[model samples]
Target: MFVLSSPSGTGKTTIARRLLAEDADIALSVSVTTRPMRPGEVEGRDYFFTDRAKFEAMVEAGEFLEWAEVFGNLYGTPKSYIKAGLKEGRDFLFDVDWQGTQQLHQRMETDVVRVFLLPPSIAELDRRLRGRGTDSAEVIAGRMARAQAEISHWDSYDYVAINDDMEQCFTRVKTILAAERLRRARQTGLVDFTRELMR
Candidate 1:
């Protein structure tokens, strides 16, 4: 399992997509949320959209691996989907926050590779947020404030990548994934295969 967490505009989703495109075994873990569908977001594809009451009910039922309220909406990863991915030996990519990462580590018998991405600088972050042209200046200011809080949790992650150069950052993330996949715990099947080859 891989937990890829970052502030709103740090390109975590882009890295996740690139990873899936490169690895045949990796599967992006689609999360369920109570947030309104953004334009072009499709049901059951981008996210499983639901109402706040229903989302709270899932929480009470212990159905989610982790849940967090963000920007007046709730987002969570369903526990069942993760279990199914593990059964299939699939690498699941979680584009969640640090809170979700902690929950997953406690509840699952999974090897989690956590990578937290940081913007090149506060100035660059501001530029990128404004570049979206979707949010007003007031909203952009709020996001910058929130981003500081988010990045403060950098120490909680296993690896940190500064996305100054997109291509370089992508390469670093890919390298991290390749190295993590070779961990002894993740390569149980490979151990036997290698032993047979040695014989």
Candidate 2:
């Protein structure tokens, strides 16, 4: 139920991993995509990489909760996995874009918590992208251009964290998680538990 979204080079994945490492209750939802694997990626860990045909078939089968085609690849979240996590009373993390967040909010409004991560500046975004050194100059330019469009949707999110300092950003996200987990709706059952104790 924790949907963490950020643009391509904002270090969302790194923050997610650190959060997962620190909290055993949080689990990351692996997205399935038609994009090819990067050098260090594993089959199911990074993404469930598949061909365009398979991705289209899954779409036809009504398997994805949300899907979007970006630049030339398709990315989607599997519906079954998210439901399973919620049923088991586990917190699931999503490293997704705003479009996916929209679909998720429509499907599970009360149970979802969304956070947006922003870079300190466009210059910093370029620096981070270049630091990765994975893509060509042309691809980085494409990502930078797309980032503006992506960031324009920040208002749709519940919380926004500027990634100026990693530790501060992590602390802010953690604070939001703690507060959201105690929201009145989420803690509805707590009243009954306490009443039973009093009785």
Candidate 3:
């Protein structure tokens, strides 16, 4: 599991999109959310939309690998979907928050590569949030408050990248992914190949 986490408006989504487009080996893990689907978001592509009741039921059934309530909506990773993908030797990219990252790391420590993105400055973050023009002043205030809280947990991540420039930040993120992919434990056929060579 490769996770990219950041406060809202820090461009984590943009970096994630670029990484997904460029890396065929890594696939985005579509999470299930109780939040209403926004405009331009596809049902299964963006998220598996559900009601609070159904989301609670899924939690009760132990269907989620990790779940959390964020901004009054419940979001979770479906355990089975990720497990099946892992079994097929596929990597999953997770766009999650600090809480979700913590849970994933606790459960799958060796498999999880956690990366956190930081905004260059609070002023820039505010500008980017307002630039979106999707939220009201009150909503943006709430997000700003939450952003500070989220950035406090920056030390928890395996890698931290300050997104001063989108392209540069994306390059750093891709580099982390490339290096993590080459970790010794993740190299599947190494032992067998070495044994055959010795024989």
TM-score of each: 0.84, 0.82, 0.88
Candidate 2 or 1, higher lDDT: 2
Model 3 TM-score relative to the real fold: 0.88
Off by over 4 Å in 2: 34-44, 48-54, 132-140
Q: What's model 3's overall lDDT?
A: 0.92
| lDDT string, candidate 2, 1-199, tens digits | 8989888788888899899999898888888999989999998788899999999999999899889998899999888977987787788888778899999899888888999999999889888777668889898888788888889899999999998988999999899998988787777588899999999
- Candidate 3 structure quality by residue, lDDT tens digits, 52-159: 999999999999989998779999999998989988989999988888999889888889999999999989999977866888999888878889899999999999
C-alpha lDDT (0 to 100) for residue 106 of candidate 2: 90
lDDT of each: 0.86, 0.88, 0.92
- Regions of model 3 farther than 4 Å from truth: 35-43, 132-140
- Per-model root-mean-square deviation over C-alphas: 2.8, 3.0, 2.4
Model 2 C-alpha lDDT versus the unseen true structure: 0.88
Best by TM-score: 3
Quote the lDDT for 8 in model 3: 89
